[model samples]
Target chain A: MSDNQSSGPLVWLGTVLATCITLYLFQGILWLVVPILLSIILYYVTEPLVYRLTHHGWSRESAAGLVMGGLVLLLLAITAVTLPRFASKVTTWNEQKIISNYVQHGADFVESTLRTVEKYVPFIDEYMMSKARDNANWDEQLAKWAADNSSHTIMGLLHWIPSLLLIPYLTYFILVDGSQFKRFLVRAIPNAYFEKSLLLLHRIDDQVRRYFQGLMALTVIDAACLGIGLKLMGISGAFVLGLVIAVLSWIPYVGSIVGCLLVVLVAATDYASQTWMTYGAVALFLGVRLLDDFVFMPMTIGRSLQIHPVVTVLMIFVGGAVSGISGLLLVMPVLGVMMVLGQILGQLATNDRLTARYQFRKALLRARAQKGLEA
Target chain B: MLFSLGKKKNPRLAQLKGVSLFNDLKLSQLRIVNSLLHERNYLESELIFDQGDEGQALYIVASGKVRTHRDNQPEDKFVEFGPGDFFGELALLEDAPRSTSARAVEDTVLLALFRTEFLALLELHSSIGSMISYALARDLSRKLRKAIVSNENPTNL
Candidate 1:
């Protein structure tokens, strides 16, 4: 008993070390797995469209081909058209607008703030100048850090490029052969738990599908409202602002706030004299958010998801910590899927009280029918 | 109970997969049936049809529960059905009165298609009829198993 007790700590330590090593060794493989998982989810989301076309008497292969072909064409067109336009827009913004305005306003604000501070503490100006010197010299430190980090940085990029390439390829195959993949997955599960596992998987899949579709719908509504509101407010770059808001909305609570801040800042910079316009921009975001909470979210996404705001926020943080922006956007859906899986698994594990009730009702009916025959 | 032997109309209606009769329908037949599906919704406790009502459309529960009952049956004798389960199919296929009255157990959603839809499905894809029949057979077998188990322990209640 003493020996066993003494070995317990050792055993746990060994287990922890083994886990760490295994994770380290398999990190690249895990990176590769992300695109595969992402592609599978994308396939499920897109499959209904293909299925609809096929259902209309089109051949399965033909339907898949047509949809895939159209998607490719659309992507090619967007890349060809949008990429150059976006680049030129960025260039124009940088050359014509960005540097001069930002520097002028920023310099004025800094000078005023420093003057106020120096009025209180005469030595504060010297202290601030030293701080400014430190900031101005930050690039040297960054350069040194970059030199030190070069090997790891290159390695990380090399690691990521293959995973990035895998996404499109994986999505393509998943789109083409998703049914076969499902069959393969189902076959891999043990027979004893096959039915329950399949049911749980299907439930999770359904939840993800509905949540994603609802999110897409909500994104569109958000973009439309934000665009129209901004346009009505006579805000320049309404389309870009709306696009940013729509994309950011995927990040949940923080996303909208960030978009609001950007809009407010832009409004402040654009119409500094017309302060009311800044207030209007803030009001617009707040109003839309209220509408989202009261009507849009409930109508589009349903209250059944019932995720707590705190948990939603925490998940966003955890997701960002784990995988940056993509993780932040996807974490809620991942949590949603996990919640559904937990519910279904719980139901499966529970004693069949409802099924028992069903059985009892069936028996009572059967006995009464037999008695009627005898009479 | 009208069914015509003509080409389909409104392709979008038949394209959805969750309709009760067409849940397992082949892609080829779905295009045919897509023209035949009629979507309908009901409030809580609404009666879809009486047991003796002429059955026209086979009903598929989309988003809510439904209850089916035969006339002269005890109140507790109704069978509860949920999403993906369907009823009134027998009448649609056989051109007869409904075997059971269907009531919305909750705020219910349903997708229905008439005899023409099934006929269109049948004409377009021969495999679907057999697939439905096979599924129904398997479902009946499962029900029979439950019935047998209950019969063995009636006194257990």
Candidate 2:
């Protein structure tokens, strides 16, 4: 392989190892960083509004305060209306024999699908009912496991609370002192790289801002479409389903799958005809996913970001592994910043600037030559 | 335009400390700016300044927003100015006529610094002159880059 091909894998492996080591070593600091990360993401999304407000004669503080207040109000509205309904539905689903129906049907589906495939492929037929037996007893084991692990989980949650608190506090300071923060960063950088750093910061900020803001708009659109469709179908818990799907959509591919599975489960358990409701739920999910992937996403983020689906999936997977759900939520923006860094690195490694300059110069020469030839 | 900065604390002026332009300046210099700022209030639909008028003060959005637009047309292209954002700087800094008229988009309060007072501060403390120039240049570059992206025409940049 050429030097570039060989170095690519080596560099990536190094990065993976380095990331793992850092996370392992500084687990405590990671908590504090999470909120700051979230806040920065929020800042990126809200900065344009701030700029607009500032342009119109509102002070930055007042604009930020208004935007933050508006955001808090929005969150409160969602909590007040949606939370109780969501909890009630979850509780009912657990209590009303729905869980047993789901597990039985799920196991049946798995067995049937495996058997059909095993007829051709034979070796994979090792998937037996023994796995279902093991899972049937899973709840009994789970209670014991929870009894043993509850303390650790609680401790971890407690550990995370402080970090969560720190994040919002950090965010407030970041917002209040954002200008000074920028100046401090700029001055800290040597003058030679100041312009490039500023440009990089602006690009990263813009990409992140657009991704988050566009996603927020898309979530509303998705939820509205899904909720309306479900309501039209007279499906119970359509609003909850819609809200769940909208939030899940942020997690990329697997998130959507989970949302679809949940909707299907609800439809299957709640309605009389499993077949029709299954079909309806599947069609609804597929239709919305199609519309989003084909139409809305393209018009909004895909066009601006130009990220490929394969890359998007892989990034989401890596992000999931690294920081769990939060990582998945943030992966796209992080990838955007990384991609920008990658391009710069690629340029440096290949010394591609001369080639770019030459190409442009060649175009100019060709235009001049064509003009002379015409004359 | 001159207003005294007494021992009484002002929240709006205190917030000015966070802005980059005033970040490096001494507290005393900020006190000077506070003294120079005049509190101006306007009703809805009131014109703060008109296009082609010499901008006499850099207006900071104190409590409400203002709308900026060019000479009369169908729709006013509003760049909503709110708290902590300073405008009329283009005219104030360049000594040019206002590029667009600033009208109170709502019932608004503004902190205004007269051009003469601003000039006098720069005259007294020349360091601010360079700082303001640097800040403007930086801001203009950012705006230009943003315009390039939004307009989808890099050649314009």
Candidate 3:
């Protein structure tokens, strides 16, 4: 919640350059990065409980172990209770070819809409609609794009599963030994820069904590809004659907589209006799999305990770030009963190007193190291 | 000195136990606390910190001596700290400017316990944190009482 301190222009330039390069690299080693990202989230999610246990007189190891142990037990219990029922339902659904039925229902809605549109405007039916269509080049581009993207989604999920399984193990160590690792890193900083480094680290840690906490609050609000609206509108399992969509929205742009499309599909199939229900569902989704952008977002995530509207807009375009989709999605959070790092580094670079002390410490240390080794 | 507890073979841990702030911590906890400290050396008469500098650490004299006095006021003296003694304890509790400047009275090695790391220790291991906090509070109480008594009798000096 603390506003990031001001830094020099050089720092801002460095921050942008660093963010672009990091986003570019993330596109390559996504396998490693994905699990690390998930683990960090899981770490943040469970850290407060561990801290609570430590406050009650447990050592870090015991507290972390107990917390993670309870988590594993809860997960296993959920799996044990749900997996058999899920398997049975999936088998029954597959026999009915429910997926194709849903697709058919969606197609029916599209066809009816088209027919209605044709009534209002003649030459809109299939026969003369071909005359209104563009050319071979556009069709070819659409076909090529579909072919390129079609198989990757399934393959990408498969590729990430094994890595995703590493989240719990990684998160556990981060909970238990994270402080020790921090100490190890701190030990490497020379004493001249030590206090400043620690201060910066504390500030960064607080910022990150607030950011994640805000994210969780957003998820709860979004789920409650969507769930209650859909339930009131007579959708079955609406709360669960809303929860899934809210969680999916955590992944940024791609997730939002997929989640919206999924809800539209469910609404279409579930109320095949009432095409109006599907229309209402779509309308509801858009309204929630609008509110998310204009209100909920500012109240939650935006409050913690504040950026100037102008800089955010500019960096978005720059991010798109440099690294494409991932950059566009990640630039904001990366900028948030980079702003803090730059502020601290800028302060260090400009502090003549600290620089003098650093030089003295280094010279003194070097002389001590070389004292008996001289020829 | 008699209550000081640590294995004699590990001199660094032993030295940490000698400091009142860390005296009550177990050997294992002391090691954890010890790892958070940064070591620095200062030549005789070298400035450790300025009067107005943002205080971020409590500096404990590991060897030699240190003097605290106001900047540019030769007659204004606060206190002198020798080996096993610490100055700048207030920095651990909050972010504030130093009330007095510190300089090495002799070639000195200091173990600096920074606020951020110490606070992390407080979160992760409260017993170690509470022990040190108690020591700091007790020391501050003593200083306050002394100041009050001194004010009551100006000739006590």
Candidate 4:
């Protein structure tokens, strides 16, 4: 809805439609799409430092290589230092048993709430409650499913490892040769639409870059706010939980609910005698959600997307309907990029001189081709 | 520091080095600037840009000719540009509409340095940016002085 994109609601709707369709298509090629998308994020995140080094008289190739090389070394060093400790801690815990315990706690909480309700209205008896509990053996069903799919889950992860490995390699090249590649693409544009096309490219690049950087900054803010709040509330593993919760919240509605439930579950099981802390945790989540609404959301990625709330909510539903969770996760960025593309194409189509020049160029080429061929 | 070294690698480097906006830049610096230019070819009588259109870049004529005229002005009242000459410098600084239209006078090859790219260059390389901005300011100031003198004394232009 910015002035440059005064192309009207149709363009907005088209942007939504294109984004939904693209998200659906992307789901089919997720292995490649996921890595490329991640690489693009990594590229944008590290681009400033690389370009800064280039500005300091270093050749772009060396600058990019040095930046990426240093980053990889740093990451590897961190992993080397932390992974053994993390792995040792994880191995000490019985993950399946822990999950089952949490699930059981959640189910017990629901049953107790129902039992309290039944006490108020005694017509619904213990016989009916037992039948309902038998029907809803969610913990047992989940445990069975996990036990069956353990090897299959490992195989699925193994499938993704190679594609994920492409990130550093792809990011390094994109950092080094991206501008040269852009120039290569620019060469194919005719003289008439040259400026418009180049500007369009710039705008699209800018929109995506802003969206990603904003998201990264937003994540950091969320993690800090939640981590500090939870740590103050005496929540165990507060920072780690906050980090997990923040990353989970990246998936919009589903993520927030799952994240909230996770915190509540951990709270309930960890301190069964102190019920007030669980309520406090829930209140803290609500407080953070409100803060996100009034402040962080506007200050970050939401501003970059620039879509109306109704449309964003609607597309999220449409996205979920079409491609499920991946669609929901990617809706905002896809819609943002699509909106820029739609607006630019709208502007280009409306330009009479540019189109005329394009036609004239085609005519000139045609005449040259036919010069000596005609009988 | 040596222009001849890179110029032999690519002749266009020498041509790019000649533009006063970039003439002071070292050969390696010149290569960075050259990488930013978008080369376009225009046939005779083809409009390069129209009056009132938002200016995004300054164009340097690498070869052939271009002519500029104000809105509704006759073709006779046009300023000509040839090799090493650049136009649309005003666009490089601001997001204002072009005050005049430009068109190719003959088959021409032009190199465009866009505003966004130029601004980034300014932020990135201070010395090179200072040189280009200084040259631009000097040329614009000279034109302003010429205009003032012409208004004060007729036939001075």
Ranking by TM-score, best first?
A: 4, 3, 2, 1
**Which regions of candidate 4 fall more than 4 Å away from where they truly are?**
A1-3, A9-13, A55-58, A85-96, A113-134, A146-155, A364-375, B1-8, B145-157
- Candidate scoring better on DockQ of 2 and 3: 3
Two-way DockQ contest, 3 vs 4, winner: 4
Model 4 C-alpha lDDT per residue in residues A192-275, reported as the tens digit of each score: 788877877887788788778877878888888888988998887888888888888876667789889888877776666566
Best by TM-score: 4
- Candidate 4 Cα lDDT to native: 0.79
lDDT of 4 by residue, B30-135 (tens): 8878878888998777789888777889999999999988866665877899999999999998888888888999889999999999988888887878899998
- For model 3 chain A, the run of ten residues with the poorest summed lDDT: A131-140
- Tens-place lDDT per residue, model 2, A1-375, is 021232255445454454444444434466655677778867767777766775566665687877777876787798799778865755565455445565444444444544556677766635564465456666445434544554555457667765665544455556656645554444454322322334445555566668778877888889999999888887777886898898888777888889887776666555544456656877998999999989988776765666668867886777778766656666665565555555434433453432453354456447656875653
Question: Best-fitting candidate, measured by DockQ?
Answer: 4
lDDT score for candidate 1 against the true structure? 0.61
Clash number for model 2? 18
For model 4, state the Cα shift of residue A131 in Å: 7.1
* lDDT per residue (tens digit) for residues A43-84 in model 1: 655677876776687765677777767776887798798878
Candidate 1 runs further than 4 Å off? A1-41, A91-169, A322-327, A341-375, B1-131, B134-157
For candidate 4, what's the RMSD? 4.3
Q: Score the docking of each candidate (DockQ).
A: 0.05, 0.02, 0.32, 0.40
Rank ordering of all candidates by DockQ, starting from the highest:
4, 3, 1, 2
CA lDDT of each candidate? Answer: 0.61, 0.63, 0.76, 0.79
- lDDT for position A310 in model 4: 80
Output the lDDT of residue B19, model 1.
50
Rate residue A217 of model 3 by lDDT: 78
lDDT of 4 at A206: 86
Write the candidate numbers in order of decreasing lDDT: 4, 3, 2, 1
